[model samples]
Target chain A: MDFSGLINDFGPLTVSGLAQGAIIALFALGYTLVYGVLRLINFAHSEVFLMGTYACLFVWGLFGLDQNSAAPSVGLMLLYLVIGLVGAIIASGATALAVELVAYRPLRRRNAPPLAFLITAIGASLFISELTGVLTHRNQKGVPPVIQAKPLFTIGDTTVTNLQLLIIVLALVMMFLLDRFINGSRLGRGIRAVAQNPDSAALMGVNKSRVIGLVFLLGGLMAGVAAVMYNLKIGVTRYDAGFLLGIDAFAAAVLGGIGNLRGALLGGLLLGVLQAYAAGLFGSQWLHAASFVLLVVILLFRPTGLLGESLGRARA
Target chain B: MSVSEKATFRSSGGVRGWFGRQPVWVRGVVVAVALVLAFLLPYAGDIPLLGPQIVTEGIDWPSALFNMSYYVLLALGLNVVVGYAGLLDLGYVGFFAVGAYGTALLTSPDSVLYADTGWKWLMAVPVALALTMVAGLILGWPTLRLRGDYLAIVTLGFAEIIRIFATSTTTLRGDRGFASIPHPPGEWGGKPIFGVTDAVPYFWLGLVVIILVILGVRNLDRSRVGRSWLAIREDEEAAEIMGVRTIKYKLWAFAIGAFIGGLGGVLFAGEQGFINSQTFVLQFSILVLAGVVMGGSGNMAGAILGGALISYIPDRLRGISLGDTDLYEYRFALFGAVIIIIMVLRPQGLIPSRRRAMELKDREKEVAPQ
Candidate 1:
C-alpha cells in the first residue's frame, strides 16, 4: 500500500527491528526450553517475565531513581545495573519455580491429562497478572532511564542508538552462553536426554524433577534479562504488557522451531523485521496483525518451524 | 467387579443412585420441574433466602439473568469444541465477534454498507450464524491438522486478528462501533415486547434459546456425530485407525460450536442495541473456557452451571466491599486461584460426564506404579 514509505524507512526499520527482535529472542528462549522438555506451552511464563520487570524497577527505586532523574555517573550506573539485574533474575526465577510448584507439580503428580495442565497454566498466569494489576492499580510504571539512548552511529539516515546496540549485544551474548550451556554442560545433557525420551532419561538416572526445575530457572533468568532490556528500549512496563509480547515471543519460538534454541533467535529477528516492514507498508496498527498472519502462513507450510524441532535431538 | 469398583458403586448409591433408579416418567418430571424453576429465576427476589443471596445487588436481577444466559450460551458452545471434541480453541470469541459484526453490518444504520436502510434483527440472525460457521470452518481448515497446542495458539491468534480488524477497519467502525442496531422484534398491546429498559423479555428469550440449544446438543451427543466426537477426543489416532473420520468430526464440532457462540452474539447485539470491538476481548473467551472446565467440560449440565456461575459471581461481587475496595476488583484473581484449586482437587470438574470420569479413573490406574 505504501511502497515508497517502506523503502525510505527500510534502514531505520531494520535497525529498530533487530533491537526489538533481540529482546523477543531472549523472551522466546523461556518458551522454547520448557516446551522441549515438558511439551507444555507454559502460558504463565509471561508473568514470570513481568515479575522481573517490576523487580528491576523496585531495585532502581531503592536508589532514588525515577524516569525523570538525571543519568547517574558511570560507576554508580554500573552498580545499579548489576543490582537490578540480580534482583530481576531472582524474582523471575522464584516466580517460575513457584508457578511450577503451585500450578503444575500437583497436576503432574496426579498424572492429570494434558488439558488440565493448560488450564492450570492459564489459571496461574491470570492469578499473577491480576494480582500485579491490583498491586499496581493497573498503571504502566516507567522504567528509570538507567541507560539513555544516545545515537552511537549513523548509516544511511539511520542512527543506531546506544540502547539498541546494548540490547542486541546483550541478547547475542546471552544466547551464545545459553547455547554453550545446553550443548556442552553436564546439566544441559540431562535436559536434552529428558527432552528426547523422558522414560529413558529417568532410567538413566537423569533426575527428571531437578532437570525440569533447572529448565524453568534458566528460562526465567533469560526472561529477566529480556525484561531489563525491554525496559531500556520501551521505557515502560505494564501488567498487561506480557500478554501481547508473550504472543510475539511464542510466535517467534514456533516460527524458528519451538524446541530449537538457535531457531528462536532466527525466528525472533525475522518476525521483528517482518513486523517493522508491515508497519511501514500498512501503518503501525497492522503490526500485530501482520505477525499473526506470518505465523499462520509459516505453520501451514512448515509446521515444524524453519529449523524444525531439534531440542530433543542429539548434538552433532 | 473389582473391590475398588464395588466400593465406588456403593459410595455413588446415595442421591445419584436414587435418581438413576427412578422411572423414566419420574425423571422427566424432575427435569421439567428444574426447567420451570430456571425460568422463574428472574422472580427469585420475591423468595426468602435464595432471592437476596443469588440476585446481584449492583445490577437489576433480570439484567444479571440476561448476562448469565449469554454466558451460558458461550460455555455450551465452547464445551462442544473443548469438552467433547477435545479441541482447545482459545479464540472462541472470534466466532462470537463475527456473529455480532455480521448482524451489525446487515442491520445497523451506522454500518457503511447499510447506511440507507438496515434489515430487521430477525433477518440478520441467520446471516450472522452462517457467517460465524464459515469463519469457524475457515480457521479450522488450515489449523486443525496441527497438534492440540498449536491449534490453541492459532485460534488465539485468530481472535486477536479479529479484534485488531474490528479496531482498525473503517468498515467495522472500530471503537466507535455500529450504533442504533435494531433489537429483536415483537409487540404486545401497543408496546414493543423486546423494547429497551426492561430486560426480563431478553432473559426469557435467552432461556428459550438455551433450552433449544440444550435439546439440540443433547440429541447430537446421542447421535453418531457425537459418538465420533467422543472417539476423537479420547484418542484421535485410535479413532482414525478404527475408521472414524477425525477431521470431518472435528470440523463439525468447530462449526457447531461457532454457530452456538454466534447465537449468543446476535442476542447480545439485539439486547444492547449497540456493537463495538471492546465487547469481544480475549478474557471473555477465557472466562467461558474457565466456566466449561470448572463446571464439567464434557457434561452439558456442568457447562451450564459453570457458565451461569462465571456470570453470576462477578455481578454478585459488584456491590460487596472488602475493606475500602470493592470485591469485584479481586474477582478474577480469586477466580484464578479457584481454578487452580479445582484442577488440583478435582481435575474431572464438578459435574464431569460419567464416561469421561470412568476413563480418567482407568487412566489413573494405568499411571499408578506397578
Candidate 2:
C-alpha cells in the first residue's frame, strides 16, 4: 500500500471526499426514506436520479448550452441553474411516483413476495436505464460546465475548490430542511405512524398509501438535487451515472443504518472519506471494492449500521 | 397425506389437465419425442418451415442454441437458490467468475499457472466446481443471516467485487482477456468430440450436461433436502421451528447452485476458447434471475424453458434490421419490459409448479370469501 501517498495527501482527500460524500448523502436519502416507509429497497431510485441528470441536461440543451458552449454571464448562469434544478426535480419526482404506481403498488396490492418486488424493481431499473442508454447511445454526456471550479483556499499543499464548498453547503442545507420536514410536519407524522405500525396507522386514519407516496416524492426531490450536484462536480453524466454512484450511495445508506435519515448522512461522508483514503493507499480501481468490503465488515459487526434505524420509534 | 387432500385436489381444468391425465408410459413417449425435437432444434434454420421467406440468415443457429443451453444451465442452477431455497442471490455471477477464472487459470497458456502446472481444461472442471462451491459457502455463511433484500444487495456487492477483481487487478488482465484457452480434448471415431470448427459439438455437450443436471436436480428435489428447501421457502420461521436446519439447507442450495453455474462457465470457457471480465457482467446474473422468475421458479421445466427463451429471444433478433440499427441494440430494454410485463400479468410464471399454483389459488380464495 502507498502509505506515503495517502499520508501526504490527507488534506486534499478529506476535502474532495466530503464534497463527493455530499452528493452520495443526498442520493442515499431517497433510498433511506423509501426503505423507511415501504421496507422495500426501491432499486429504481438510481434510475430516478438517472432521469434527473438527463432532464437537467435536456433543459440546458434547449438554451443552446452544448458542452463546448462558453459559460454565460452571471445572470444567465443563475437562470440556467434554476431552470435545470426545477426540471430535474419534477422529472425525478414524477418518475419515482410512476414507478411506485406502475411497477410497485400493484405488487403491493397483490401482496407479492419480497422476491417478486425485488425482481420487479430490477425490471423497472433495467428498462429505464437501458432506454436511456439507447437514447444517449450509451455515451457519456459532458456537462456544459455551468459551475466552474474556482479555488477557495490553499493550506499546506492542499487546495479547497469553490465547487467543493458549494456541494457540501448545498447538501447540508437540503438535509437540514428534510430532517425538519420529516420531524415537524403532519404528513411526516403520518409517515412515521405508517412505518411504525401500518395496521394501527390505518386504524388511526393515517392514509398510509398517501404517506408512502409522499415519502417517495421527498426521496425523488433529494435525488434530483444530488443529480445536479453530481453533474456540476463530476462534469459528466451518462445513462449509467446513477448506477455506479448508486452503489456507493446504497452502501452509504446501509452503512449509516438503512431506513435512518441522519445515518445516511453519516454513512455517506464516512464512506466517501474512507474511499478517498483507500484509493490513495491502494488505487482508484479499489475504491468501489473498498466500500463494499467496508459494508460487509460493518454488516458483520452491526447489521443495523453505525446509527440505529429511526423511521419508526416512540420519539417525543 | 390424507383422503381429504386427495378429495379436495383440484386438477387445473385446461390443456395441462389433459396432458397431466395421460398415463406414465404415454407421457414418457411424449418426453422422448420432445427430447428428439430439442436435439434437432439447432437445424431448424435449415429445415425451411415456410421456405426462404423465413430469413434465418444472420443468426448462426448452433451458436444461438449454445447460448440458449448456457442460459438454461444458469436458470437451473439459479432455480435452486431463488426458486427452491427462496434466497435472493443477486451476485450469482461471482461464482460463475470463480469457475471461469479457475478453468482459465489452469488451462489458458496466458495465465501464470499455465507455466507451472499446465493442466488440461477437463482436469480443471472438477477443481473449478469445487472452488465455486467453496466460494458459495463463504458468501452464504455470512450473508444468510440477513433478511431477503439485504441478502440480495450483499450478493450484488459480491458480484461487483468479483468483477472489480477481474477488471482492476493485473492478474486477470482486465479487458484484454485471457485468450487461446485450451479447448477440451478428445474425438469420436474420425471426428473431434465438440470440435472448434462448429459450435454444434459444444451445444451437444451442453445438452448432455443439462440432461445430467436435470436428472440429478429432479432426484434431489424429490428427496429430503428438497423438502427442507421447500419448507424454508414457505416459511423460514416455521421451518426453523420444525427442526429444518434452515441455514444448512440454504447453504446446500447455494453451493449446488454455484456448482451448476460454475459448470456453465467452464463450458463457456471451453467453447469460446477465451475468458474475460466482460463475459461475467452483473447483468448476466440478473438475466438468469429474471429467467427463473419469468419461466416459473420451483419448476425445472419452467426454468429450462425460461432460460432458453431469455437467450433465444435476443439471439433471434440479433441481425434483424430496425430502420437503421439492428434489433440487438434494443434487446435488453425490450427484454426488461418483457420481464416486467410477465411478472405483472402472471406473477406465478408461464408454467408454474403445482405447489405454487395451489398457493396462488389459496391466496385468491382468501381474497374472495366463500
Candidate 3:
C-alpha cells in the first residue's frame, strides 16, 4: 500500500490541513464558549462566520480592493487587509451580540429548558441564513484577491500558498490570544468561575450575564477573523454558507470535549487533518461521511470528547 | 412537594373513572363537529370571496385532511418517543425513511432487489414496520443510557447516517427516488375501502389511523404501562426504585414510536407513490418535534392538533400571491416566528392532556390560591 509515498506526502497535506483546521478551530471556540455558559449549541455561530465574510466583502468593495493592480506594494495591501479585517470583526461582534440579545436572552431569562433553546438556536440560524440571502441578492460573491507573495516556497514537492500561510499564522495568533484571555485575564477568570459554578460565581460578585456576553463577543470576534481568512482562502461567499460549516464546527467542538477551548482547537486540527488524509486517500465525496463517522465513533467511546470534559457539564 | 402532592388525584374509579369523569358527550360533539366539518368543507366554497373553487379544486378538504391526518400520525408517533418516553430522537425520520423505502423496495414494480420475490404490497407494510422497529432497537439499545442532549445528538447522527446512505444508493433509485409503487386496493360501495384512485380515501385511511393512534396512546397512558412510562419520564431512577422495569418501558416507547412512524411513512409512500430520502430530512424531524412540543407534550389531542397546524400552515401560506411580494419567501420566517411565540407563551401546547391540565391548574392554585 505504498506506505512510504503516503508518509512522504504527509508534510504538505499537514500544512494545508492545519490551515483548514485553524478556521474550524476559531469557529469551534465560539461554539464551545457559548455552550460552556448556556449549555446550548449556538447554531447561529455559523451565520456569525457568514456575517463576517459578508462584512469583509462589503469593506473590500468600499475600499476598491480587487485584483489587477500591477504595482507590487505589500505594505499598502497589508494595511488594506487590516482595515477589512477590523471592519469585519466589529460588524460580526455586533451581529453576534444582537443575535444573543434577540433570540437567546429572553429564553434564558425565562429559564426555558435546553430543548427550547436549541429550537431558538435553529430558528436564529435559519433567520440569519435566509436574511443574508435576501439582503445580498447574490448566491455567490467573489472575494477580492489578496496581494500575492512569490509562489516558489516548496518544501519536498509541496507548494504552499502565501494565503494559506497567513491564514494558519493568524489562526495560531488568535488561539494564543484566546488562551491568554481564558487563562490570564480577570474576565477570563470570571468566565471560568461562571462555567465552573454560576451560583458560586454569582456569590463571588461576578455579573454572570456580562461574562456570558463577553464570551459571545470574544467568540464573535474570532469567528469574524475566521470569516475573513476563510473568504481569502476560498475566494467566494454564500448566504447558506453556515449550515454545513456550523455542523462541522459543532462536530469539532464535540470531538475536542466541548466547552474546553484548547480542546476545540485541537479537535479542529485533528478533524481537518483527518479529512484531508481521507480525501487524499479516498475522494472528496467521502468528506461529510468521514467527519460524521469520526464524531459518532469518538462519542461512542468518549462521550465527553477527546478533551475529557464538557462545558455541558460545567454549565449546570 | 406541594404541586406534586396536589397532582395525586384520589378518585379511585381507575380507567372507567378516567374516562367517565370527563364530559364524554362533549368530546363526542367535538369529534362529530370535525366529521361534520369534513362533510361540509367541500360545499364551503359556495360562499362569495371564499372562492368555491378553493374547496372544489379536487385538492380541497380531502387533501388538507389527508395531509393533516398523515402529520397527526407522524406527530403521535413522535410524541411516544419524545413526549411519553422523554427521549429526544432527532433522527426519527430515519425510521420513517426505513419504513418508506422498505415498502417501496418491496412493492415497487421496478426495484431490482425484490423483483424476484413477488411480495404483496400490503405485506410490505408490516414487514417495513418490523424492520424499522428492529432498527430502533438496534440503535436505541446501545445509546439509551445516554441522557438529554447527548441522546439527541447520537440519534441525530444515526438519522444523518441513514439519510446519507439513502441518498447514496443509486440502486434504490438514489436521489431520483423509486416511483410508481403499486396502489392499495380501491373503493367498495362508492367509497374507498383502503383505496388508491382518489385523495379522499387516503384521507379516510389517515383519519382512521389518527383515531386509532389517539385511542391507543390515550389507553396506553391510562393503563399500567402508561403510568410506568409517565413515571419514567418524570424520574427514571425513582420509577426503577419503585420496581418499574424502566429499560423495558423505554425500549417499548422507542419501538412503538418507530412502529407508528413506520406506519406513517408507509401511508406517506402510498399517497405519493414515490419515495426518496429528502422527504425525511432533519428539517422534517424538527417540524415533527415542533408539532409535538407546540401541542401539549403528553397530550394526544395536542399532538393531533399540532400536527394539523404544522402541516397546514405552510400549504396555506404557499398559496398567497400578493402582487410581486411573493409571500412564500416570508413563509419560513413567519413559521419561525410562530414557533418562537409558541415556545415563549404556550410551552405546554395548544390542547394539553387532561393530567397536564389538572397539574398546571393545581400549580397555579398552589402559587396563588383562588
Candidate 2, residue A166: CA error in Å?
Answer: 1.3
Evaluated at residue A96, the lDDT of candidate 2 is: 91
- Interface RMSD (Å) of candidate 2: 2.6
lDDT of 1 at B211: 96
Specify the CAPRI tier of model 3: acceptable
lDDT, candidate 2, at B66: 91
Task: Report the C-alpha lDDT of model 3 over B1-370, residue by residue, as the tens digit.
Answer: 3355334533424653454445769668866898777555435656698654454232355676677777888899999888788888877888888889888888887677665754666878888889989988977787766666667767877787778777775666667887877666665889646555557677767777777887888888778888888888878899999999988888888888988988888888888888876777777787788788788778777788888888877666665668876555666667777777776665456766556656555654443111
lDDT of 2: 0.86
Per-prediction TM-score: 0.96, 0.95, 0.87
Compare the candidates by lDDT and give the number of the best one: 1
Q: Alpha carbon lDDT of residue A157, candidate 1?
A: 94
Error of 3 at A25 (Å): 2.0
Docking level for model 1: medium
Ranking by TM-score: 1, 2, 3
DockQ for every prediction shown: 0.64, 0.53, 0.31
Enumerate residue pairs that collide in model 1: none
lDDT of each: 0.90, 0.86, 0.76
Per-residue accuracy of model 2 over B32-72 as CA lDDT, tens digit each: 99889878876766765652333244667788789889899
Q: Please compute and give the TM-score of the first chain of candidate 3 against the native first chain.
A: 0.92
Q: For candidate 2, what is the total of clashing residue pairs?
A: 0
Cα displacement (Å) at residue A240, model 3: 2.1
